[model samples]
Target: MLYNIIFIALFIFVIYVFYKKYSKKAKTIPPHWHSILLKEVAFYKNLEPSEQKRFQDRMMQFLAEVYIDSVDFEIEELDTILIASSAVIPVFSFKEWHYPTVTGIIVYPDHFNEDFEFSNKSESRRIAGVVGTGRLEGKMILSRKALRHGFSNKTDKGNTAIHEFVHLIDKMDDNIDGIPEILMQNMNAIPWLKLVHDKMEAINNDKSDIRAYGGTKQAEFFAVASEYFFERPKLMKRKHPELFKMMAECFRVKF
Candidate 1:
């Protein structure tokens, strides 16, 4: 009985210590609005003062909850990446799935190579890209160069971080076919599939601004669409209204 009481007391003490430490960290972190880093996030700069404040609050909450890797990378650059990513939140606002499945972001100096196995084949192939990969458990790998390109290439219709993050979102329900659970929930899968298929066909026929890579697969289509959706919302709205609407509903933000 004495040993049991001692064990209980130790557990309570440990919990108390952890809570105190967490509280201290929380207190030291300044409010999002005052974060000097926000000045560096390009997208944040484009927003109106009120919208910027809203985004700042959202970003601050995200930083508090998510494990961000700023080491070996400029803090301002990291802030820009996170802010750009957080913009997706408004796009997915109509859905209950706001937070990314990946909670941790690992930034790399540049594009990295990874060996991926092909189905029904014994050989593995090496692939290189800006953002290497992601998982549903809130883990994402980003290439700094790719991230910059995604933001820089307004006409290219490719964003590595957004592409990889979209994959993470699609994997939230443990499936990765370019269709996220939230987008599929209240909508018919056929239309979504058909729209993507048609878009891919149009791309192949040189009828769209989407890159050839976007026509590679349904997953690629989703990622490419995300690039266009964010970088050229007005163009996407004018060219593919339904697709734009679906993406808007998926992200819950107005373009």
Candidate 2:
């Protein structure tokens, strides 16, 4: 009985600690920071005033939770704002959602190469951002240049930060297989699978507007599609309505 009491007390203490920690996170944005978002983040301008307020609130919370540290260069205010906004956009619809899988973000000076064993060649590529895995779990690395480019050119269907963050979201279910089980129902799984396959086929045939990189795999497809959905929503909706709808359902947000 004494041991049982101790165990229950410990559990309660842990829960209380977590509650206190998260409850203290900032939920409101300061006016200066709000202006920064207004001037710097293009996506913020796309939202309605009410949504713009929610976006700022969520961004403040994100910045409070996700530690942004510099890799080789000094982290700038715009970097933090843009990074926080990228993190907030995808999960904005789920008020209670936070990226538990991501512990922090590392900002690099520019495109850097990291050795990966994904292929037999063990080749290195100039990467803009990466979501951690295995021993590097709970972390993300992004390039300062790429982050600037993502927000600077709104018409381009690319946003490296969002792409990496989507990968993190895809991994929330303990898997990054492109099909986000957390947001997708089991009954709709097969349909989602079929849709991905069909779109990939069209991409391979050069008949699809989705970036060719998306056709590489299911995981890449999801990330690349998310980049396009958020950056070029109108083009995506007009060219690939079904895929756009699927993305809208998964994100619970309309671009």
On TM-score, the candidate that comes out on top is 2
TM-score per candidate, in order? 0.69, 0.87
Off by over 4 Å in 1: 1-48, 70-100, 115-138
For candidate 2, give the lDDT. Answer: 0.84
- Residues 87-154 of candidate 1 have per-residue lDDT tens digits of 34434343223444555666655554554222234243222232334442455666666666666655
* Angstrom error at residue 162, model 1: 1.9
Clashes of 2: 0
TM-score of 2: 0.87
Which consecutive 10 residues in model 1 have the weakest lDDT in total?
122-131
| RMSD from true fold, candidate 2 | 3.8
In lDDT terms, how accurate is model 1?
0.63
